[model samples]
Target: MDTSLDDLDHDYAASIADRAMRAMAEQRIPPTPTNFAVWFQYFAGSHDDLRNAIDLLIDHNRPFDARINQDLFETYVAPQVSAVVVDTSERLHELMGTAKDFLATAIADNHSQIQAISDVAGQGQAGVDPKALVAQLMNELARAASRATRLEAGFAEKTRELDVIRDSLSKSEQRARTDTLTGLANRRALDEFLRKAQTTAEWGEPLSVLLLDIDHFKTFNDNFGHGVGDQVLRLMAKVLREKVREQDLSARYGGEELIAVLPDTDLAACTEIAERIRRAIAEAKITRRSTGEVLPGITVSIGVARYRVGETVTDLIERCDRALYLAKGGGRNRVVTENELDRAEAAG
Candidate 1:
């Protein structure tokens, strides 16, 4: 007897699962569900990028630690996060169409009842019982009232559904734009806000960008592990949130770099704000929670650049980065501005 397709498929999947688990065991990785999924896909050779990344990690003898595992899952798996928002939006649209169709049906039903009443009122022929006509008209009105009640109930249900979906979409979009570690705006959100600010700048409004970097962030991570490093980042984000105005935006610009977008602010004001941030971070106490040890205070290097009229956002960011490079080169915890960068370049 020929083997059934279902059995063959099951056997294939079982073989892949066995291989995936064995590979994780060999690497001494924990048999977590996330790790299993990643390895299962790896063995299946479904995702090219995921497979290549795993292969590279293997070649380098990198440890499959929790952080690396989470990174792999996010880079390969959780990128479909936006798809949730899109799916929710489509569901919302479908619900609206359902509501529209329901309203149209209700309207048609009411019109038919109104026509029945008109027909009864127009009947002037003899032997037409007036009592019977009145009874029929009352029955029609009662039915119409029932229909109206049903419509109201249906609409209320749909409205509740809409509220739920709207909240979900809002949350999804927020998660997509927010950095999970620092609780600050992520790079994507920063790009969007900066582009909009650039539009405002075109009208001659003042704008400034500050790029702040935690001094010796890699050293912190290397010595204290990612947990302590994360605490330092969170501390920096908190300081930034307190220092900047409500109208401004503070975002994590990848890794240990954080940014603030200041609208209607000139170069001097931006520089002052950067100094304030530097001081605030320097004053904040950093402690390692695991060992209850008080670490040294942390400081940041800041680069400030005022937006130039007719310049692209990229240019502004690049100038700010150059100034940041100067600050880091000069010392680890100072503020530099674009004007100073120009002078430094000229002197060189």
Candidate 2:
């Protein structure tokens, strides 16, 4: 067999093994005898072929160390893998420390060599036969200088490349998370905010969500047409962005619905903010193009719900939805609080 062809085959096999390992880790499968046997059977083939493929993959993906693999496996596969991963990680850390010390020593030596060269050049005395000593020093200095220069250049180049990559990634991420039409965060972004809010609530910070729906938006679309409707939506989004705090998130949650996530905000503050937004929407003057006819005013009904310490994202959303329904039922263009509903029911 051709050597290059064999190498390609080996690489392909290794990639397959790596994918399988990743799958097992993600699934949190333990490497117990039974589990291992099942996994092996699932990826059935000649034992030698499988082993060779795995070995090739391991070699190619040198960063996939035992510690990382084991940690992932523990998180996804089995609890026992945690201890092994921890031990391996500790060992790797120790090795890294030793390597760093070695590098530091080498850098110090190079610095000392450069210093000696400078000292010799500065000395005015020419009587002493410093030829042999000077020659040896010069050779050592040249080697160290060349190595240092190359290392610095390589580091700078890598830094520049990384910065370009980071900027590109940031733009891509912003595009993915933003709503193109309204300039607000999209549904996907809202989901991410909800996840983070849940974490914040767990850490004893208050979280609140406000769901706002433009009252009778479909009627506006039907009367004014979609082009004008889109402009109205954009205007609403602008008002929301201005009204919400820096730490808060405002997103277009599909169609005429929008959501705001307030971290470290209580129910009262959220209600006030929602009311302000509602007022802003009602006061905005939206005009039509063809006949110079100004459309009727717009209004939003808002539902406010605060984090109930141990509530899940879904639970919080449902409560807010219920409040929103009540707001719409009671009247359009008003804010409703979940706590208010509880109080009303109690009084009734």
RMSD to native, candidate 2? 14.8
User: After superposition, which runs of candidate 2 have C-alpha atoms over 4 Å from their true positions?
Assistant: 1-147, 202-205, 287-293, 340-348
Q: Candidate 2, residues 1-348: lDDT per residue as tens digits? A: 111224447666566556655655654443333234323423434344434544564578644332443333223334333454465556556655655665686688778877877766655264445786677567877877787776667556655655665576567668666766688997678888889878878988888989998899878776766568778888999999999999899998756778899999989999999999999999988887677788899999999999887778889988898888889988878999999767766777
Report the lDDT tens digits of candidate 1 across residue range 208-296: 99999999876777787666777888899999988999999999886678899999999999999999999989988888888889997
Question: Over 4 Å off in model 1, which ranges?
Answer: 1-46, 53-78, 124-127
Residue 17 Cα positional deviation in candidate 1, in Å, after optimal superposition = 14
Where is model 1 poorest over a 10-residue stretch in terms of lDDT? 1-10
